[model samples]
Target: MAAAVAPTDQGPLAGLRIVESTAFIAAPLATMSLAALGAEVIRLDPSEGGLDHQRWPLSQEGASLYWTMLNRGKKSVTLDLRTEEGREAAARLVCEGDGIFVTNLPARGALAPEALLDRRQDVIVVTLDGSPDGATAIDYTVHAACGAAQMAGPAGLDSPVNNAVPFWDVIAGRTLAMGLLAAELERRRTGRGQHVALSLSDIAMETMANVGILPEAELSGEARPRQENWVYGSFGRDFETRCGRRFMLATVTGKQWRALLSATGLGTAMDRIGEAFGAPLDDDAERFRARHAIAALVQDWAGARDLTQIADAFAGTSVCWSPYRDAAQLLAEDARASPRNPMFARQAHPGVPPVLTPRTPLRLSAHPRLAAARAPDLGADTASVLGPLDTAGKEADP
Candidate 1:
């Protein structure tokens, strides 16, 4: 019900509009991604806030940093969708600019996709659910069920290790963004709208299949053993330097393999080991088979040098390697994680101090990148959004 503001003449998605009602990761991330590309996203939450309003990684003032970062560049509108008036207002807004609606929450009454589409045939509705059958689920549960957790962590460990990152949720978010754009394109071409639905569990399962985990399990009749830091089907793992710092090194390509050998001065020794194994190390599978021997020499060479020396040895070479760093170290050391990178800017949110934030990683040759914008305080835009909605629950003319 907000007065329609003309989209800024910047970024690829300039003129696009999206109305979002979502919580936690996937749905919020999808809209935020579009917002970063210049879509005007209006996010609807309950009068107080949504379930993730106080999600952890909070600032000292108890503001949710997670929510702040995820909701960046979005206008916040608080509406008690449990009421008829609130739901009507939401439906009216959804049928406005671009006629797009996205949510992971249950839609009923006036907020239903069918009702919205009935109101405007060309409306695009995107919904994300935990499962096709409506079962309750989350990233950790999906990851465990998909068999990924079993294959993570140290080799020979008895317990399955869940990754700290919610990869499935992240993937689902990007997938939703892609599907939304595809739907928009289809609507533009045919002048018809349809609903786009996805399940978080499906994303995890499909990713496992795409990465060959399912086939490997089916063919081998066994679950994959945990690999720790070792790269699958290649020679890669972690090594410690004399300075007691650890780094991950991987040699997937022949060029990378050769570079590692050159950097470590172990070409002759590796060649001898390859001859002893009756196969050349140039082949990926062969290197994987002889990884223990290969890693031993590399580890010894690395252990004799400091982390700086190791970095110097591999500098400007095709040797793919990176030193392990915690979050603080990453912020302090990596230029890409700091304001030095075009993707990042330091910005303050509603109740949080200025922190390093990011714009869309996508670069458009035609449009200049937009600066990262702060998230609005809760319900900050409610009056602006609802002001134009007349008492009769209809949008008045601007």
Candidate 2:
């Protein structure tokens, strides 16, 4: 209630303010990014708290690191929007706020219209929905039904496997931030407010646009099975090297393939190794792996090795050596130069950096991208938020 800290140092969207009426990932993240960019973001949550207040993947003492991570430096207001009093309080706040984000979707019989749009004419209203248009599904359900989980990998002996990570969250977070920023940018230009809506399903589909629509693009609905770590026409697949030191996983391109051959002690002339590893069949996966097997033989292939080493080794290489990193590992560095997160820091652990997912990848130089207030703590500033309501409350208390 005293001094509200701006989330980041970016000045792309300076002087912008947003109100969050979201429950979980998508909506909150959208607003969080806005706050990170120096926008005054006030999150409206339920007084009772949501599922995230005490969910899984906890710390040793059962602390919801999940909640802490997502809501690191955000202010929260626990007003009951379902009640008339609560609605009025929120309406008043939204009417005055520059931006408002909600988890409610838009469509046939969906949005509450005037109820949530208290400031329809004054502020930016961003919504996060559950599904795309007429359909709906949760994160896991969507991932399972959509073919992402199916194509994750081949079974050792039985059924297929699913990716362990919550890939949809990452994708949806990205989509939500992008949508919110887009809306904010437009508002800045027009000097008029607008509503921006997005759904987890929509975000998920967009994230998998290349693969989800691959079947449709090819004129066939028969989707491709899990390729695991292999892509078509790409030889020299990821394999374990000898000495069990680290894994050599990368997206080998044509030029990179030549380098790999030389790096692994193979000769410059391709014809020389044809008899031993077979001829390079252009983009043949089998031939590439065969030729690349020599390097794999010495590379520590299991996932046990630190993924960082793999990424570090390919820092400036032509090889699209895209190694898979866990959510925690990626945010290890401070704000990066390419659309970085200067606001993200270890507010909880001091010097220990908190784990971050990823930024929206959208950049704005002139506009303050981050530098806003943290999410509130269950209407902690209710008196300040709804001062008129407080006056009314005092008058009605007999």
Candidate 3:
């Protein structure tokens, strides 16, 4: 390839380089973030591509949309690390440039910290694992272990309900990105590399800690109760509109509650319902305890009007509400057209239609705009990458 185009202004991570040897979401997403911020990210996959290359939700041509979305704007090199030559090439790739390697692969045997550090002492090695002790796990298993599945469904359901979103994987990916950036900054200051390790379980625990869920349960000896379609500890729920559209509404503050009542024209009805319970619906706790009564009034009002009518009513109010939309609806309205979407870049692949992908959410005035490029096909850059590595190895030979 001709010299990579040099942008007039590079992003905040302009001088950084990250070598990624991981499949799936967490590790790939972490490096992708760095790549978006202008880091040179070179990803390594097995000779036939990693498991993620075959992930479902593919295009008509059987290309992995999941893999393409996660690995966007990164160079891809495929190698069979089981071979001695492949191992040498992998080591050379790790030791090249800024010498930062991120992977979720096994911590022992091949491609471990010891092996990479042996190749380059100043190499920054970051590994994300299922547990701190190197146990293997994926998002679903980690999410299940974190207690989220148990509290997911409606009240009175005995079975666990797994969420559609891979919550732990998303969090762990961001966590890994945070660690990589921090290590980069420290490496710049100290001129020394470090090994950053993160576990999916640990990330889940941190998330619980941040939300105060574990502490609340420990102190009160009360497990979180399922409140399907309702905001936990609050008076919010999903109601069907006259047009058969489901909408979620929440009011966290007194002002919001008053506005919601006004928006629905239900203040008087709420007052009457509150009187039936001999309780004033003036606080969150009261409304929460009497949520059934409150929801009845809301349902009656909301059910009598179409989504458009309800949306018009909410336009000038402080009521927090949105109509439930499926994937197609969201893609048509929010993802494709909404100004709120930060990842709005459109990239065209050779045989594929243009795709709209979200970029890193960080918005920095000093940083240059991120590059918009499609994910490379398997081993697309292998010759360009390995040719130079081979030349360097021969030149350094005695």
Instruction: Specify the highest-TM-score model's number.
Output: 1
For each candidate in the order shown, give its overall lDDT on alpha carbons.
0.90, 0.54, 0.80
lDDT of 3 at 331: 73
Question: Worst 10-residue stretch by lDDT in candidate 2?
Answer: 343-352
Task: List ranges where model 3 is wrong by over 4 Å.
Answer: 1-9, 107-110, 272-282, 335-342
* Superposed Cα deviation of residue 138, candidate 1 (Å): 0.5
Q: Judged by TM-score relative to the true structure, which candidate is superior, 1 or 2?
A: 1
Using all chains and alpha carbons, the TM-scores for the candidates as numbered come to: 0.95, 0.71, 0.91
| Tens-place lDDT digits, model 2, residues 1-398 | 54444455544555666666665565566556655555666666667766576566576655565565566445666777666666666665666455454555331211244444443654656666677565666677667666566666653424545556667766776677777677667777887666676667766666567654554545775766545555544553455423233333443455775555444433444444455566653445645455455333424233333555544445566645544335454444423422255533323321223443333244454443433233334557665766765676688897
What are the RMSD figures for all models against the true structure?
A: 4.3, 6.8, 4.2
Tens digit per residue, CA lDDT, model 3, 1-398: 54444455467777687888887788998888878877878888887888788798787777888888888879888887656677667777778777888988754444678887777778889998888776778888877877778887778899898768777888889889899888878877887787899988898878887898888888999878877878777789899999999988987788889999877778888998789888888888888888998998888888889988988999977999888888889877564444346546667653346777666677665543555667888899899878888898799999
State, as a TM-score between 0 and 1, how close model 2 is to the true structure: 0.71
Q: After superposition, which runs of candidate 1 have C-alpha atoms over 4 Å from their true positions?
A: 1-9, 391-398
Ranking of all predicted structures according to TM-score, beginning with the best and ending with the worst: 1, 3, 2
Per-residue lDDT of candidate 1, residues 1-398 (tens digit): 54434345357787798999999899999999999888889999998899989999899999999899899999999999989888888998888657999999989988899999999999999999988888988998998888988888777788888869888989999999999999999999999999999999999989988999999999999988888899999999999999999999999999999998888889999999999999999989999999999899999999999999998999999999999999999988889999899889889998898899998888665555477888989999999877766544543435
Clashing pairs in 3: 343-358, 343-359
lDDT at 28, model 3: 91
